[model samples]
Target: MIISILVLEGPYNHEASDSAYNFIQAALAKGHAIRGIFFYDDGVYNVTRLMDPPQDDRHISRRWSELGATGIDMVVCIAAAKRRGITNEVLAPNIRISGLGQLASMIHESDRIVTFGD
Candidate 1:
């Protein structure tokens, strides 16, 4: 099965991004395909590659990075990200900065749009 996810909550507060993260990891472990991960609302924090949490906590940033290394496309809502300050690196292509057009595009091109929101 092909699974795509939309995270509307953020990793800073609770593990709202956890569902998507765990889901994606499990899907890959089971040999399923991950279409992509779309971040919305506070979820845009997931794309801020500059995050640095204390050593006592889970390195949320690295976990997401690992997903990227594994080739699962991760996208953040452009408008939402701009408001919260998440952006794309000039060098990262797949992690491009995008908007609802891209979100709609993902929706149009995917099998599911599972959202994790408050």
Candidate 2:
């Protein structure tokens, strides 16, 4: 099954984000393809490279980076990101530093869009 996940909360002081991360791993392990992981609200901060968590804890940013490295498509809504000071780097001919359009498109194209709420 193809899955597109929408994460709407940040990682601090919550288990929801970590739960979503584990769920993604399980989905991948079950041979389900991740169509996209879209971040909205505080969740957009998950992608910020500037994140520096405690040394002993699971770094959510690094976890996400690893997920991205696995070839899963990751997206963050522009408005939400801007509000949280998260910046999406766009270094291409078509892609730009922008909004929820790509995520909405991914949702529209996917068979499912699961949401994680805080």
Best by TM-score: 2
- Model 1 per-residue lDDT at 39: 78
Q: What's the TM for model 1?
A: 0.84
Give RMSD to native, each candidate. 2.4, 3.6
Q: What is the TM-score of each candidate against the true structure?
A: 0.84, 0.86
How well is each residue in 14-102 modelled by candidate 2, as lDDT tens digits?
Answer: 67788889998899899989988887887776676766788998888778877877777777777877776666552111213456888
Global CA lDDT computed for model 1: 0.74
Report the lDDT tens digits of candidate 1 across residue range 6-94.
Answer: 88888868667887788777777998777778878888776666777898987776787677777877777788877876656521334
Pairs of residues clashing in candidate 2: none
| Model 2 alpha-carbon drift over 4 Å, by segment | 89-97
Query: lDDT score, residue 44, model 2?
Result: 74
